[model samples]
Target: MTHHPTQSPQFFLTAPSPCPYIEGQFERKVFTHLVGDKAPEMNDLLTQGGFRRSQNIAYRPACETCRACVSVRIIADEFKPSKNMKRILRRNADLIGAMHDAEPTTEQYSLFRTYLDARHRKGGMSDMTVLDYAMMVEDTHVDTKIIEYRRRGPDSFITGKGQGELIAVALTDKMADGLSMVYSYYNPELEDRSLGTFLILDHIARARAAGHPHVYLGYWVEGSRKMAYKVRFGPQEHLGPKGWDRFDTEAV
Candidate 1:
């Protein structure tokens, strides 16, 4: 296949599959391979067009009848934490997140398995083995990083990296506009700390520090209880029929 750095990619559609988020619905995806020298540039363009990268592929919802899966990106520079979010940050104050190259390890896989078994037992990735986990983290062609959240040790300030046991992990893509949180998992037992929310918060801070404008949070489905938490990140932009639009219910 001819690689086109400045041209549109050839997209293929996936066969219908049961919708993981919405019941009684099916999901189809329109995807293209992210490969060759132009992969990074292509990935960036597609991401701005609401495509999500997975391994060597980039895909988006192409359902026939449903449009509930809306692409959501937080406006990092303009975001302000809510009172509850402030509490979550305070609760996890003892922990630090260290960004590392996209490499897999046994420890991360162990935590991944534990997280899946506890929280996503019936989800598609629940049965993935260690090798599969490794591929998920390392197979991407575009820029990716694994952020490890660990309890702060005595030397954490100087090292600028965390120490001790890993409590959460975020698989993120460094996009041109902002950081894209591809996936994140945390110790399910530590419900009070709200590690998931903290990860998003950290991504926002990271994006702002890097002078990026947004943090992609993948798709948010309306009425899907699994995705309801995404709405909490206020002043997010949702890809709509008319392009990106501000979606703040609080303004209503």
Candidate 2:
């Protein structure tokens, strides 16, 4: 099959499915395929309009009557790490991350398996086989990078590549506006490190160093406490009915 460019990007809504992040509510997505020669350009447009790229699909929530999911991106150059976030950094200083080209591997799939079983056993991707994980990384048509975090090894610090068991991984997209984290997971056993928070902080630093102004953090669901931590990254701009606007709510 091939992709054809329409005058405008066509959006198709998905059938209802059980919500992965929130309980009791169903979820739907309005998505378009990112394929063929125009996939890259199409993806850029979709993402700027608040969609998240997953594999070859660009998707956004389309739940009936629900507006809980709001797009969020950090102004990297203007961001300052909070006291708590600073602590998370020093806490995980032993851990190091190496960014690699988007390539699928057995090792990545193994970590993905462990993460889903330990943290998201009840979620939709819990049953994904290695093939699915492969597609998750390799099927991307846009510029993508896979950043893997592991324990520091003998030659790692100098080489800038870690050599040890995979502790965490992030599937991120490089867009014209900023780097969008498509998905991220960690070793669920390491609760004290707050690996999730550290990853977000690191991404902000990365975007800043790369000269990108924003670091897209996907959506921030209001009522979902599990996702509430995302808002802690202060000086964020949330996409509203008007457009991307700055919001500063009291920190948790």
Candidate 3:
């Protein structure tokens, strides 16, 4: 078969590895480097087609037998907080999330370590060093940012920054269509605050304010308890064989 060069990008597949979300299943991925002049545009196109970015590479699951990993993006403008989610918002009212340029800090890495140890101690990223974390935050070529959440300070309203201890952080990418939440970590000690859910809630608000219609939440596997929370932020669309399709809460 003659291969036609339809574009500048080249794709490659990864060797199968143990699936992190599901036990006993192996997962493979198709990926391409995201760089140079067309990085932003290509990132946007691939993301809409179910690909997610990690550092400078964009990848999506390409397992032969399993298709449980489904891409989900929230309809920012239409999301309504449930009673429990509203309570989470109230619990974290003292916290403020300020957006900053894609920069890494020792303080951020410290919290990242703590979170990984507490929540994902056995996961692949649990052993990431400070330098590894830095690359994860700063290696992107597209428009990216870090949102730091902290207690509201006296001058927070004017400066749009908080002053107390860092409670959470979200590494996000700004696409032409929406914000893609690359990764997020929070103070694992504050389990009562539900910071993970709070972060998503905040992202929805941020995307709506920026006039973006969606907030990409990465892959949501149906049978994985770890991914069940994603379905709560409804009026979301799932990428499928026919393209993006509406996901009904009842159907899930």
- Local accuracy by lDDT, each model: 0.91, 0.86, 0.93
Return the TM-score for each candidate structure.
Answer: 0.96, 0.92, 0.96
TM-score, prediction 1 = 0.96
The candidate that achieves the highest lDDT relative to the unseen native structure: 3
Q: Cα RMSDs of all predictions? A: 2.0, 1.9, 3.3
The TM-score-based order of candidates, best leading, equals 3, 1, 2
Clashing pairs in 3: none
lDDT of 3 by residue, 1-252 (tens): 534233588999999999998889999999998887789899999999999999989999999989999999999999999999999999999999999899999999999999999999998898899999999999988999999999999999899999978899999999999899999999999999999999999999999999999999999999799999999998999999999999996576
- Residue-level lDDT for 207 in candidate 2: 91
Which tens-of-lDDT digit does each residue in 1-252 have in candidate 1? 655343556789999999998889999999998877778888888999999999989999999999999999999999999999999999999999999899999999999999999999998998999999999999888899999999998999999888888899999999889999999999999999999899999999999999999999999988888888888897899999999999984742
Q: What is the lDDT of residue 111 in candidate 3?
A: 95
Better of 2 and 3 by lDDT: 3
Q: Looking at model 1, report the run of 10 residues with the lowest lDDT sum.
A: 1-10
Q: Deviation in angstroms for 176 in model 1?
A: 1.0
Residue-level lDDT of model 2, residues 103-128, one tens digit each, is 98888888889989998888779999
